[model samples]
Target: MAARSGRRRAIRGWLGKACTVIAAAVLVSSVGAAAAPAAPIHAPVLRAPAGGYEELWVPSSMGPIKIQVQWAARGGGAALYVLDGLRAPNDHSQWTSDTDALRQFANDNVTLVFPVGGRSSFYTDWYRSSSTNRQPITYKWETFLTRELPDFLAGYGVSRTNKAIVGASMGGNAALVLAAHHRDQFRFAGSFSGFVNPTFPMWNQAMRAAMWDEGQFNVDDMWGPAGDPAWSRNDATAQAERLRGLPMYVSSGNGMPGPPDLPYGAVNTVNAMALEAMTMTAAQIFRDRVAALGIGARIEIGNGTHTWPYWRQGLANARPMILDALGAH
Candidate 1:
């Protein structure tokens, strides 16, 4: 584990430099430091929220990755993946700071994995590059959490199976993508105030209008650039057809454009003003596509914006669903 820490630190040291890429300049101006931090990130806490530990995960290909985990020490087993929204922080995210959701969920003895690093990788494995095209972002996360993280958890006496994946915004998409690709490991998936669409035109269709801001990063760069086949493969909503028994949770709010239904509140409002409308609309349409799926899932249009408070509020609807799934264990 110490070795893992060393490797993760090394990766972040390099990533801190590459965070100034052209795509970041275009994709999000407010997220300037999302890609800047090295691990051991600080959360502006009035006080520590409960108890948790931080660990570094190292994959053969990705080198080292920082993952902060929280869990109840005494109870049955469950694994939950908490993804960082765009502009992620290392120690804690809106996922923990914005609400009491973690208190409710962790009380049930679920293991929470928070992956912190908000580069262009989008938490996916790059198709042609193993850190080739992008030097700092090797994009080897697919293996680190999926293969090595779980093994590391077992060492800590954590649950190895009955995993549930969940997150908001980009993290939500990542949770879905991870679970969809590894159904054998992830029995349940959820996205709160999630960006649910991968193919903007094919599904939400609104993103094309709202997504061009900052430096104008084409979503394809995060997936595979335009005309690339990998885009088809990673489309989150498209993966729905392949999710036979896997249950899903997805939602989008009003902060995106005109509606004003951001789940979190202040943060969402700030983001709305700070971000380009194209980005918000893109996320909204993605959620709409999830609702369109009409699968054995839950998708809602809420009253708030995309702030942590709103997402925390949405959890009232989302929590039971996730717990019910985890209870299956």
Candidate 2:
């Protein structure tokens, strides 16, 4: 009931913000060649593939993004295009090492394409009115992956027809948006602990923080002093209902109420409280409204914060559902 109610609030909130997204998610221009050169992309340390896991990198328009391939050691099956999290570093990250997923899904005979290197572009092209997202101009990542990665995998023996895309955090939003906009690309999509709303005030704040770190999220560029239109379409909440038939898996923490301790010390008491309240509220909002839309989805809630340990566990819990969607043994 709580989750259901949370979904309602989210829907209302999203509906209210959709108009803003139209303006906020405005495509200004690509990272013009006139802009400073993009930072050099570093390659990930190639880790040894366990059993079915194979290490490789696929060519993308954005350059060569690293990929960890898990080939079906047995016969042959489907494919899963896994997306990474926000804090994905070159050395270690979720897409690079699912840890248990390879061993767990080996018998399923599916190929896993774990691509890395889209730091914060949300895996979308950005030529300011980009052909893909038609919003933002930080980078042109979306075109490279959706257009190129699949072909690369197909050449390597990953079945194109049975492919599924799943991700966490920002990547989840990408998975949802990509799947919704291009249903032909994926048969199923999953988003765990995703920052779905690009236009939500909270999401707006997060983008500001991320861009501020990279010297990109100027207050003006983000949303033009709040209430920006383009911002909302960038958000998952605003477009969640648009995804009708895609099998999506969306989950978030219960936003356990308490003072969250950072790697250092307690600096944000108020923010933590707000986050807790908001997460709890958003979960319920998504639950009810999405269910009403008749989209096949699975929602999980419990006592966990927005951390990788929790996501890893959640993946295990939902692995069966993934297999079910893929029609695997």
Candidate 3:
């Protein structure tokens, strides 16, 4: 009987040891599961279709400004900022609407950026809101383009410093003004049928008339008055010396009907001709001023008019120089 009790005690001890071992194993597994690392979360990519453009709402002090962006074909970091004219629409840039800009740069290794909506604002930071039209927001495009937009673009692999700017008509002068002041941002600047010299005689009146006709925006709201220093500050010709080291392309038509102008009706063609003539005069003044300052710019004067086709051709002509300046393939 004593031998039997001893065997039972021995079995009970073995059972206790087995249960402890199993409990320890289960605890280790629970601790291991709790210590495992989790999967990481990633930010959404800011990209477009394979060969198309995407609309990105970039934040700015002026509000959330919408910009149309086409990523580089070969994954380049350089960008080309295409500015719109005085009659710029709020929906999209005229560059995308009127010209074959997308197809032209589809295979190129440079990101294309088109800033939308700044009709008759001259793409400049206005001194005050327009009193005539009671504009809701004070225009602050200069700050948005130079500072806010660049900072936002840096996160998307686009170089803030390596860039080019081009514009037709109103945007043309604004491009030069931006390049002249912010040399660190733009490597190249181009003006196609742009009114580069706003301080020229009778030009301010022309601008005033054009602004009123387009958007009822008073010119006084833009630069304060006709004799304000802001006029000279914004004038590309007045700031010619500032553009000394920058590569520039300036082109204008002689107000004559070119091959591109043949498709339009008589009134439209005549209007384009008149506008081109005036813009050409301003462009020439800017060119002469730059020349006097010993600044070399590719100045092309040919037969065309202030129309999309001519500006499209101008962009095509400036493509090689622009690509070279930006170090794009």
lDDT of each: 0.51, 0.53, 0.75
Q: Encode model 2's per-residue lDDT on 1-329: one tens digit a residue.
A: 00011111111111122222100110111110111212222221112344334545666655566665665544355677777654343432353343355666655556666675555456665434223233334455567656777666665555556767877665777777777767776777777766665664555655555434322335343235456554555555667676787777777776563322232123222233233344445556667768776656777766644544445665667677666777655
Ranking by TM-score: 3, 2, 1
The TM-score of candidate 2 is 0.70
Order the numbered candidates by lDDT, best leading. 3, 2, 1
TM-score of 3: 0.85
Give Cα distance to truth, residue 155, candidate 1, Å. 1.9
Of the candidates numbered 2 and 3, which has the greater TM-score value? 3
Which candidate number has the best lDDT? 3
**Native-structure RMSD, model 2:** 10.9
Per-residue error at 34 for model 2, in Å?
Answer: 38
Estimated TM-score per prediction? 0.68, 0.70, 0.85
lDDT of 1 by residue, 195-272 (tens): 555555432222221222222333444455544666655667667665656777666565343332232234334444
Off by over 4 Å in 1: 1-60, 90-94, 128-134, 202-221, 256-294
lDDT tens readout by residue for model 3, 198-276: 8877677777766766667888988978789999999999999999999999999997896776655566566667677
